[model samples]
Target chain A: MSNFSVAFRTTGSVTILALNGELDAHTAPELESAIQHCKNEGAYNIIVSGAQLDYISSAGLGVFMAFIEEFRTLGGDIKIAALQPKVFNVFDLLGFPLIFSIAETEEAAVEMFSKGTTHN
Target chain B: MTATIHTLAIPSATRYLKDVRRFILRHARKAQLPDDAIEALQLAVDEACTNIIEHAYGGSTKHKVDIAIIVDPTRVMVRIRDRGQPFDQQSYIAPNVVALTRQGQAGGLGVHIIRKLMDQVEYLSEGRTNEIRLTKYRTH
Candidate 1:
């Protein structure tokens, strides 16, 4: 089976990507493309909700690491929320917990963005 | 409860690893692992297969890549063999992720992640083939 199914929805300046299924080497690019579109649309903040996400790979992590700087350059940052333990562990292993603003719920993520970016 | 061994030879490309992914997922579901377990299996397998596609081939010109996945009821063993240049896994260790940039391979995360996810992992370097074996146990 292919790794992941991606859905995108935009609200004002925030773009939320809801990832379903697996996020591994093969499907990481699809998410990257979606993020690039967010940048193209001038969306400053990108929130990826992984509440339904099943897994992630190093390639998946690479996509997030590779795009963060570009998003920051565009005056925005990426936040992750509701990541499953198995998936979240991969991000933590890469030390992404320190780099990305992660929240326990999507509401918390939106609240975080509403509160402004202070994790810098 | 039976062992199924399948060997595949295909061109070396990131695209081709999809076949490996599909192969594993089919049996993974048949093995009835929790969704998280299956995903972990996929990650470990990708890390190993990608190492073959990148380090073993080092170039897209590699005509064929060899892969063997063994699925047993108690455990899943993936052995990927390639004829690419030789390297030492033991001599390689990942730099601390906290203080490292994504440049210069960002070393050992692959191997370290494998170790964390899988129950056992080993590399066999001999003759013209480099074999990386990763095994994960199945727990209800």
Candidate 2:
């Protein structure tokens, strides 16, 4: 219906982007730019709030696919949180459900960041 | 005998494409497309658009991409049109995934993945325009 809106704020050592709206081929660049911004800001940990994310396409997934290696190469961290079932299914199909550090809730995810838990 | 035409100026963002896949799937189902075939078609479309968004304009916001999905009883076809610089698909060598994965590198397998997932891939250049064709046959 409308373009995606993303806001970046610091939560301790993590950078959180309050992502809202659909994430498809058209809006994925915004998410990519947001992540890039975090990287440029030297954020080591990142959290993507997926509660408001209505849907995601393979192209949307590509944004993360293209960046994870670069982020890890720079010794940064990126993890997903609160994935919708339908959204999770897409990621699961792409073999990301096991690859990404996904949390059942944002609080738990943030806690994971604080404890530096294993991000598989 | 049902046909639908969807034309969208491909934005640099990717989240809006769920509807595009849904649009194609709708027709595919009516045409009796099998579940696995539909998944492959979805992946094929994604690979094509990812290439366009990343390379066609070199990620510049000023560039535009056009997509058309045509569906009928016999097959489903997706066409991606872009006015950006041309890409030579034939000379493009697909990255070796085994090596990349073994080395723990995260990317560069789009073309290879798409080739494995699709029945056919064709690229055409007309004037300054580039059009890619991805097709999968219907399964009754």
Candidate 3:
């Protein structure tokens, strides 16, 4: 069975990808494809809801790094939200909070996109 | 208590990363490490094994990565051994996260994360064997 899964939902123009389970080198490609799918479908504003995501490693973080620039160049952004403390610590360890928009909840991240804040 | 050593071996493949992480989690818990320390150990070992799979073994599943966890009263040491290309420790430089993202590069962050999370990291290359030892001291 798969150890990770990504589900897609939409809130207006923004597409929300709800990530669940462990995200490691083994499952990172799934997230990459999900983002690519969003971009291919012309959904730019994306919010990654990590409330159910139990774990994350550098490979998982790399997926975000690989795509964030492209989305920003296309006048869109990828915002992360509701990360567990453990997962957030990994992101923070790499100083990702300074680079990406991370909110305490998906609502807050979506609010940032609507307000057009450049960084968080 | 006293020090003890635990070992695990897996094929050098990304799909085995899950098994590696689980092995770390189970052993780290047995070592009585704190929650944060356990998390750090888990991630660090995962990064190391991922590096072994991708760089050392060049994504070849034919190779094997052997892992050993030495649990001491004050620290936990994870030693990973592989018979593949050795990592060039001297030539490695930490990547600028922003610059990497700006260039749309996704990799080159594993070693950095491993360094940041582990209290002590040592890389050894002898003959055809290369080993990386990641240590985390227990906090009380």
Query: Which of the numbered candidates is closest to the native, going by highest DockQ?
Result: 3
- Residue by residue across B12-127, what tens digits does model 3's lDDT show? 88888888888989999988888889888888999999999998888889999999999998899999999999999899999999999888998898999999889999999888
lDDT of 1 by residue, B13-101 (tens): 77766677777787778767777677677778878777666676775555577777788878878787778876577588765664453
TM-score of each: 0.79, 0.63, 0.97
Best by the TM-score measure: 3
DockQ comparisons of all candidates to the true complex: 0.32, 0.17, 0.89
- Model 2: per-residue Cα lDDT over A1-120, one tens digit each: 556778787777888887787666677778889888888878868888788876666556767776766666777667888887766766665567555688878888899878877554
Please state every model's RMSD to the true fold in angstroms: 3.5, 5.1, 1.1
Q: How accurate locally, in lDDT, is each candidate?
A: 0.75, 0.71, 0.92
True lDDT of residue B45, candidate 3: 92
Please give, for residues B50-120, the per-residue lDDT of candidate 2 as tens digits.
67767877767666667787777677778889887788876887664334433545445566656766777
True contacts kept of each: 0.24, 0.20, 0.93
- Looking at model 3, residue A113 earns an lDDT score of 86
2 versus 3: better TM-score goes to: 3
- Sort by DockQ, best first: 3, 1, 2
DockQ for candidate 2: 0.17
